[model samples]
Target: MNTNSTIRARRIADDIDALAGITEPDRPYTRRAFTPKFLEGRKWLEQAMRDAGAVTQIDAAGNLIGTIRGAHPDLGTIMLGSHSDTVPDGGRFDGIAGVIAALEVVRALRDQGTVLDHTLEVADFLAEEVSIFGVSCIGSRGMSGSRPPEWLQRVAGELTLEQAIADVGGHPLHSAERDDIKAFLELHIEQGPVLQNEKIDIGVVTAIAGITRIEIIVEGRADHAGTTPMGARKDALTTAAWIALGVEELAKALASGEAHFAATVGEFEMTPNAANVVPARVRMLIDARAERREDMERFVDELDNGVGAIAAKTGVAVSAPRMVSDNLPTPGDADLLDVLDGACQTAGASHRRMASGAGHDTAWMARITKAAMIFVPCVDGRSHAPDELATAEDIALGAAVLLDAVMALDTKLQEDI
Candidate 1:
């Protein structure tokens, strides 16, 4: 790596560390979406962007856009961004890591005092945690125009999309367009154990997983436990447990390393909380994910079949409806991947190309523009927890790679024009 780049990387890291230390610290920087602390963090980030010598502005959707205007007006903007909001009790590193890294990248570019071909922008997206709305990536969804009109009417209580936008200080008409940029790059920590367990410093994410969520309800006759014989009585909880375990088995059967097929039965509830009463109803949520659309569909099918078989054997009624199937698996940009890989190699950071197991904001941006994500290792593969963390050096290395990738894209756009 060149001395200029190394110096720039270190400077950006220093800036990130400083910003992370000062942000809305209500109980150690636990800022949930739309809360007062989250808003404070947003304000601090806005000021930080302005102080970094960038033109800072907020979009209708509460996305803080920090812009370094380019000399070539014909070239479209190139953006580097991530969400600043956190899940409840989430680790400080999850979303803020990306936002701070993006901020530092733009700041570092300004400190380098170089004019770019395409405008450089850093965005701190809002409401990414889904803690407030129960749906993740709210900011990016609005910006990408992927939020269906039906969703606006059906979900999020009685508040329409227009009302929600207005409440959050955004305009609906402007929220649905994507006229700004040619491409995007996001830096984040690998929230899983893949990179850390593999002892890899960086991950070039090839695809973000597509999620399919289902709410399953198993209904059976409520009866007295003492009077109802095991052979005669229908137990909803027992049947639900069978289906849940069956779902895991099916996932194993469908597992092809190519798609990384996985299913999780993360939630379960039993009705009539009493030791003497049989559970009349059991409600469970099954989350299915895969790298490819076909695989995700197969997962859904398997889940349906599993529930069906269990219901038939146990004499329990089963009903499952998909709640969310936002199945857009973001395929990373080929050129962007090349740039990221090159950056990793140049920085002497070992990287493995892998698909992200979890969804991220980049998945939504992929619909409108060329987009990709770079991931650094998280300690013990932990994320979305208060203890989740990555070493400072690892964070710096990831930021350095992001800086190089952004610079490469900036120069490429100039050459194209």
Candidate 2:
């Protein structure tokens, strides 16, 4: 990395470290979308963007867009950004780190008075977590023209995504789409220990996983635990438990060398939830994932087959109330990958090319723009919890690489356009 780049990145990293109190519990920020805490963070970020000399706007989807104008007005803009709203009790470094790092990039650019030919933007996407709307990529999906109107309106009550956007001064359904913006780049923590475990400082994410969510209900006769004979009673909870383990094993068996497949039963509900009564019905939420679309399909098939078998054997009825599937596997842009790889080498950071098991907003935005992501290591594959962490040195190293990549693109747009 250039001497100037190193100096600039260190300064940026210091500023973010100082903003540590933005969220509590020190490690996980706990700033859910549309909450008062998120509002405060958004206000501070807006001021930061303005102070960096970027023209800022809140889009209809409640996405905060900060732009630095270029000499050429007609060239589409280059977006450097990520979401700030996090999962409940999520790590401070997960999404906030990226937003602040991009802010610092623009800060460095403006402070140095460097002018590029294409406009640059930093976005703080809203409602990335399934809060108030049960939708994951609300901001990016809405901006990309992928969010259905019915889904937005028919999905909920007062906490509709439309209302959330309106609360933030955005009219997504009525606003005209911006014709500019050529590509997008996002910097984020890896959220997994692979890079750290492998002693790599950076990861050029190859693809985002495709996720399938299923809500299963198992129904059996509720009876008095004291009087019902074990052989005569049908236990819904027991049947559901059997299906969950069976699905887990099936996923492991079907996982190929090239495909990463996983099945998890994250939530379980037993009617009455009492120790004395036999559960009449049990509800389970299954989350299955894969990096390949075909692999994900197979996983879902196996899940249904296993659940059916369990129901038949246990004399219980199984049904699915809802199945919501979104986010396809998004491969990173090849040109962006080359630029990022070169940046990592120039910055003298060790990097590995890998596919992300978790989803991010870029997975949705890639459908509309050329997009790729940069990842730094998480200490122990811990995230969405208070214990998630990354060292300052690693954060600084990742930021330096991000600065190099953005600078390269900023200059490349000048010559290409």
User: Which lDDT tens digits does candidate 1 get at residues 128-154?
Assistant: 777545666767877888765554443
How many residue pairs clash (N, CA or C atoms closer than 3 angstroms) in each of the candidate models, in the order given?
Answer: 1, 1
Q: Residue 10 of model 2: what lDDT?
A: 61
Quality of model 2 by C-alpha lDDT:
0.78
Kindly report which residue stretches of model 1 are placed more than 4 angstroms away from their true locations once superposed. 1-3, 6-26, 150-164, 320-326, 414-417
Q: Given candidate 1, what's the lDDT at residue 200? A: 91
How far off is residue 395 in model 2, in Å? Answer: 2.2
* Clashing pairs for predicted structure model 2, backbone only: 77-181
Candidate achieving the largest TM-score: 1
Question: Candidate 1: lDDT over CA atoms?
Answer: 0.77
lDDT per model vs. reference: 0.77, 0.78
